[model samples]
Target: MTGIDETFAGRKGQASATPGAANVPPAATGARPSETRGVHPDAVAAIMAATHGDPFAVLGPHEVGPGVWEVRAVLPEAKSATLLTGGKRIPFERRHPEGFFVARVETQGRPLYELAVEDWDGSERTRHDPYGFGPSLEQHDIDALREVGSNVTYRILGAQAKAVDGIQGFRFAVWAPNARRVSVVGDFNAWDGRRHPMRLWQNGGVWELFIPGLKAGAHYKFELRGPDGSLLPLKADPVAFAAQKPPETASVLQGTSTPAWHDEKWMATRGEKDPRHVPISIYEVHLGSWARVAEEGNRYLTYKELADRLIPYVKEMGFTHIEMLPITEFPFDGSWGYQPVSLFAPTSRFGTPDDFAAFVDAAHEAGIGIMLDWVPGHFPLDAHGLGQFDGTHLYEHADPRQGFHQDWGTYIYNFGRTEVSTFLAANARFWLEHYHLDGLRVDAVASMLYLDYSRRQGEWIPNRYGGNENLDAIEFLRKTNEATYTHAPGTLTVAEESTSWPGVSHPTYTGGLGFGFKWNMGWMHDTLNFVSKETIHRRYHHHDLTFGLLYAFSENFVLPLSHDEVVHGKGSLLGKMPGDRWQKFANLRAYFGFMWGHPGKKLLFMGGEFGQEKEWNHNQSLDWHLLDDAHHRGVKDLVRDLNHLYLNVPALHARDTEAAGFQWLVADDQDNSVIAWARKGREAGEVAVVVSNFTPVVREGYRIGVPEAGFYREAINSDAERYGGSNVGNMGGVRAEAVPSHGQSHSITLTIPPLATTIFVRED
Candidate 1:
């Protein structure tokens, strides 16, 4: 006789010889085995067709029972197995409710393959086939699908339209084929997404539970285990209506039936101002660092406290807008909100969802527009959410080419899927619709639109001719832009794309990416380099500063000194200057004036307004004490003044919308500097002359053209002592004398100060 293992393992111990056979009679043998018996050969053929024979080869048709059979296979070799199976394999591609079957096969403790069983009727393939955010499956892959287990389960119930009182309850269901029992435990049940032990319904295939008290704002997740007490993947519920943070378990949220809103009057009363005319003088602030707990006090700032303390200051400074960094729920404490796990849930770390809504409402009431920094390119690999969700393919794809992002060490969403697109689209709408935000500034767009982005040669695939354009991603972006604009006509959407993609800011109907504006990264880079250099050196680099104009028309732009440039290894803008404190102030002042004068909207980080001396650190508060320094205080005043002018000047506000608003009066890169023009509201002969002498020495007799023969007055000067300037040349009353032009127009003669930008207005 064979060894015990050998005797029972081959073909379900079919005896390899019928017991009666030679031992008794042909009558004892079952009627000729049914042709429909054992594994269906067509099913095996389908598996071969899908994977191209990548994982395993079918070995048998041996019958083990009346309806069951033992099918064997030569598993795909171990190293090659990972490519087809392992953690990255297609999951839930095949699942059924009749028999509740999912099959996954393993070799030597490592998943070598999987196969799913189909039902007698055709309902199995039609109903359980994976799509969108659901998992993918392979043939004969039951055991493996049973291995990873379920992250969340939901039941759909049709409630009679009349049954809804003040609160409505939902029927919840979970599918855990491997679990012996399950429970709903969450905040409603006091930290139990797995309590009120769901009743095992309909042949024990599904565990179902219902809570009469569930409603929006409730947080939750589920806990499940096997008969022998082995724990399965107890993950955060995927469809959780809402969620909270650490030390507290997630609860099932009841979606809001009626969101409290008082903004209809506000929306109706506001006029339809052109977005280009909207004066976007953004003040960027980090909520955590803007204020903090004293060593002797609490460690957090309530949303209300921040609104009372900060909103008034911003409104008083004349800022038209406020842009906040990411507020998504994240696990890491010190990050700049780059790491995000939950797509639908807000960070419980800040304040409750209602509190966040109130903060935005308060800002709107104060007439300050709000822009949120949205990070959708990638997500943190936190196990509690997104990662390995629902036993497979939740937020990512099975193939690394479609799944992993090399640069961020995070999972990129499979934008190609309908459910994934819906998830993100809903998220965008959630903020705009539910929270009443004015706009969104999408973060890290470069990563989202490129396939080869941050990948090594062997790691990524290119088009047939070897190019980097991610066609699917591009299509997805096109759809996203169209849907967003269609949903909210007036809300702004800005892309932080660093690459040279064309038409990023154009309208979608025009075959463009359809963002309302792009960050103007090229301008930011060139301007920073030019201003930080010595004025003399700037003369040689003047062309670099103006190079941005070639592509400036591709989209609207915003010149931003955002958190990315200041917080990382890159030094603070103030620290980059090669001069003393006074010279440093001069450089910064000139830069700000130049930035303001440029044909784009403006943004300054919180501390930059008051001249923060230290680099940004998320763990510590902004250097608030630095405001005491005279130089620092001067910069603050300058920013406020700039804001005042930005709001009041037609020349500035008008620039926001029309290309004709800005005109260059000079382009002399040889002289190390140049001058430009800005006009307002088609007013004839009404213009603003912006002149900068990047040279170290003052240019005494520099002459530029004017529209008319009137004298010009200095509207704002970077050399003013009150604004951290050296007070050089006292431009307070310097008038540019008008000289007759060779043509019908006229000209002006003025002394342009070194390291200063002067905005001249024609005296009426």
Candidate 2:
């Protein structure tokens, strides 16, 4: 059986599983094996000197002579020590009294053993020796990690439960190449760094140590002595898989277990379909503030509770997916999870990584996808985080101009560094591979794409080519995207990009950034601005509603009324409308009608559907009670119908990103404050007509062109009484005549409501 070596590399003295040689070293001369104090002075002195750098070199076992062995231990907590295993209790010889024990015994081969100790407090305990095992990871794995560019760091680094020479221990590894000494410190070693110094991975910059007695759920942190041997702050593990809930700030050692996945069927079929042509309506949420247990101090719901409650609500609301705000482990709740300290650990606020996995599985089973808001562009400058790690700028650029994000008071990653790039790439893989998330909505992508983004001219540095682009960040994004898609084929990446930068959702092979979708921030800005104005002054801004069509097909897009719009003192979507209460609800209903009919996939932040009045507060639960009011319930009902309609009607979603699927019927109706368009599916006779009237005056017999001569049903009307409107619309349907109007051969005349939008689909 494999355990402590019982001997250290067969040093010339004695080999022992039993303590005390017949003769001991002389104390006056401090000789190897002369009769004096019953223990060798060299071994005793080495034990007293804790900074030997290699505990395995002198403290464990040694073969001093033929068929003879020596064993030693430096147990600072012990008052007495004994070698106990295989039914033999060999008492140790106490040499020099500072808890140094040495013994000698004759043995033919190495033996499995344990250390028994009596503490100064009169308590006794036994543990497997941590110093006797072989390397926890294979040499090949270490070599892969040293390459730095290879995407296998997650497999080697961090706290891994591994078996070395058949002995189980928690093998800890971290990247701190500039440190002179790195040690593992925890309650096991009385939080003393010198008690268990780690072995360096020789020029690779990684330090590792296997403490056999350690196991999952142990709290630990790394202590590193800087290059010049100056003391820096103790830092949490960058590759830690779980961390103590914040305000605690220590990484918890965890054992990796494969989650029981029920998403196999979802995975097998997602690759065959193109998301651009599918119905995608995402409901963005902040898990902490989404809901709470009011009866229990209004605390956040656990992942299990969210899985049970949130999943069914979204599915019933007809949403295809739920896009969460950043769930990565961040220190500050005020930052809304944007300032992450641990990329690998899921924020322990909700639950363990396993709980998050169950949540994803629940979503998949409910036929809804999950998208995480992944923040890789920058990190918080918390002391125990990646900032000044290893007493150097290991993960970020050394220069403030290049690395600091002035807007966020955070540090930008050094994407040009190999280890940094690999760490990010592997992290993305971990989420997809382990958690089974359907996609990532990459945050702050605009900042990553340009060097001058949000920076004054003097505050930014140009690339090597003397341009404004951030080439290193661009390369890093491409690597991460390629690796994520390669390793998890069905998964996707979306960019929250607000720039004219070209080819964002295009394939990387064609020199594009390789994203599946880009948020339509321009659409959101112009449309919201238009609807926020009074109807009397809205005619001049009619172009705002029609202008987005100019670039609607520019890239695969998701028109987002996201959290960014409602946070940071910006009023709620409902509060942004400038009118009386009735008019306010009408304006919101009409705009949502326009949005659903617009040519892009939909993404609405939490509280938008039910007309949340106050701005979103990250610390507070959503005003779900607002649904009790008719106006709020009306908006909610309208949104629910809009979602169901968008999914059922092929014409609305099948051509959301293609130019051929959309055509204008009344582009020059600004004088009447009206606009109409036809959305077409690939099949003949599949068409949807969208008309919006921005004026407060009802229009009777409003003639709009149709693609074919047939009966048209009012698919949806924001003015319907069920949706809190004035109840004005064509009874059930209208007929198309052959008279030419607005360039189409067929025309339809109908009573259109004031300040509302209506959709009509062909019935025959």
Candidate 3:
């Protein structure tokens, strides 16, 4: 056996002269030439300072001579260390006082050994050496990472649990090209940076390490030194699958276990249908405040609880889909998930990742589609987030004009960068694929399309073509849409873009940003303004209701009375009506009838359906108790009936995006405050006629044109007494006469209810 006495013979005199050797006590015996010749003292100094860029070269087993091999380790907590190989124990020499040990052995090939360590408190443990393994990533991973739209960042980075050569552990990796050094620090290593300095792949600027014996649920963070050799704040993993509940910012190790999906039937047929031609009535919800268990300290419901309570309620309300507010992990509750930190993690505020998956499964099983409000536009500048990641503006632009959002006080993603754009595009695909989500409503897309968005003249930078459009962001969006549709066939992407940039919902091959649908902000603004006016003065603003039809088919649109419209002193939808309590409810019911009759898909914020009296407060539950009121319950029933009608009637939804589906029958009746139109289905002679009276006066003998001479049955009347309105109607049916009116060969005369919208379907 070659003991420490023979290995340290020549190193005694030389230790006093080496750079960091004075701090290391001399070994017991003189060192042999084979044991001490290969290792350098300067490398030891760098390792002792925890600033080594290439720890793999100096710390792992290295061949010293023809048959001799030397091994080195930096075990900070160990009082003594030994290398166990080939059924023999070789004790290591104490090269430094900071627990740096070295051992030389005679091995035929490379050495495979386990470390036996004794701590200062007299406790002993046996563990696999972290440096014993080779690199966990390959050249293909680096090549894929640098390619535009490759979307391999998540698979390559973050703490991934796996087995390396029959030993179970985690392989931690991060992208920090500008970092001089990066270390994986966690509770396993006593939060010490010196314990696990990672090996950098220079080609991709990724640092990786295989830490044997780490289990799932272990908290970890990347400790990085900037290019200038300055230590940066420990940053949470950008691609973390799960993170610690906020106020504490470490990333948790989530194993490679996927939830067993039971949504195959939903997934199999979703891609076969076209979203534009289907009846889509969305109930927008902020899960945190949707409902709280007041008895349980008013806490937010878990994902499982929401699956049980929320899904049944939505199904009962007759909504086809539920579009949730952002549920990605975010730091500030007030941001309502707009400013996300971990793009891949479902917010821990609800439950684990698997629990969230179960909620989606429940939604699918109930025949309800689920969509997430995805926010990739901007991220908050929290210290532990992606801001200033890697000690530089690696994920964001260095220039404030291109990087900072003045209105939101957040950091805009550097979409121009290949890695950053790929990161975002992959995240978009991740949610759709991993969670089996039906759709993603991309938030704040207008902020991403234009460089000068909400900025003063000199506060923004122009594109390469000297235009205000953000070219890089535009390309990123197009590629992301392409990837999402290609990978997750049934899923769709909707843009909450408030701009008139043409063909936002068009295919990318036609020089348009490819989104499945675009939110019609103009229609929302115009129609809401028209309904909020007093009954007598509504005639002056009559065009507000009619003007939207001029460009209704410009893009596939979603007529949204979203959360944005009900918050920030904007008041509830009920509060926006200018009238007494009874009139307010009447006007809101009429507006809902009109909206359901209009030429687009639908989305209504949660409280708007029940006419919540107060404005939305993100801190508390929605005024669910308001349903106790007769008028509020009536409004809720109206919404449920409207949804059912929209779903069952082909004429109302079959050709929503086509101009041939709608025709104006009495559009220019501003003097009487009345408007009328007809909706057609794909098949011939299938039609539904809708008329609205803005004034509070019942108009008898209201004549409207029809396509064919038949009996038209009153399908829905907003002024029915059951809906809290004066009982006024055409006695259930109106027969068309052979008289020409408004260019149609047939006409029908009926009583138009006061402050109501009445819908008629051809019965014969």
Measured by lDDT, the strongest candidate is 3
**In candidate 2, what are the lDDT values of residues 1-764, reduced to their tens digit?**
01222334353321221122211122312333321223345535633543333345445655556656667777777889888745888888876666667766667765567889998888989877765554454545656653433557877899888776667778888888787667788867887775676766554567777788677888888887776667678889898888989778888887566788888898788777788778999999999999888889989999999999999999989999999998888889999989988888888999988888889999999999999999989999898899989888999999999889999999999988877888887888888877888899999999998999898879999999999999988888887888888877877799999999999988899999888889989999999999988888888898898899999998999999999999888989999998899999999999999999999999999999999999999888999998889999999999999999999998999989999999999988888889899999879998999998888889998888888888989999998999999999999889999989988999999898988999998878
> Roughly what TM-score does model 1 have, to 2 decimal places?
0.73
Residue 286 in candidate 1 has what lDDT?
81
Q: lDDT-based ranking, best first?
A: 3, 2, 1
List model 1 lDDT by residue over 349-436, tens digit each: 6677676777777887888878788876777676666654544555676678768876667887877654455456556665665567
Runs in model 1 deviating more than 4 A are 1-183, 187-210, 215-218, 223-232, 238-242, 246-254, 257-259, 269-271, 295-298, 463-467, 672-674, 709-711, 729-744
Model 3, poorest ten-residue lDDT window?
Answer: 14-23
Candidate 3 backbone clash number: 6
Provide the overall lDDT of each model, using Cα atoms, as 2-decimal numbers.
0.59, 0.82, 0.86
TM-scores, all models, native as reference: 0.73, 0.92, 0.94
Q: lDDT, candidate 2, residue 547?
A: 91
In model 3, where do residues sit more than 4 Å from their true spots?
A: 1-35
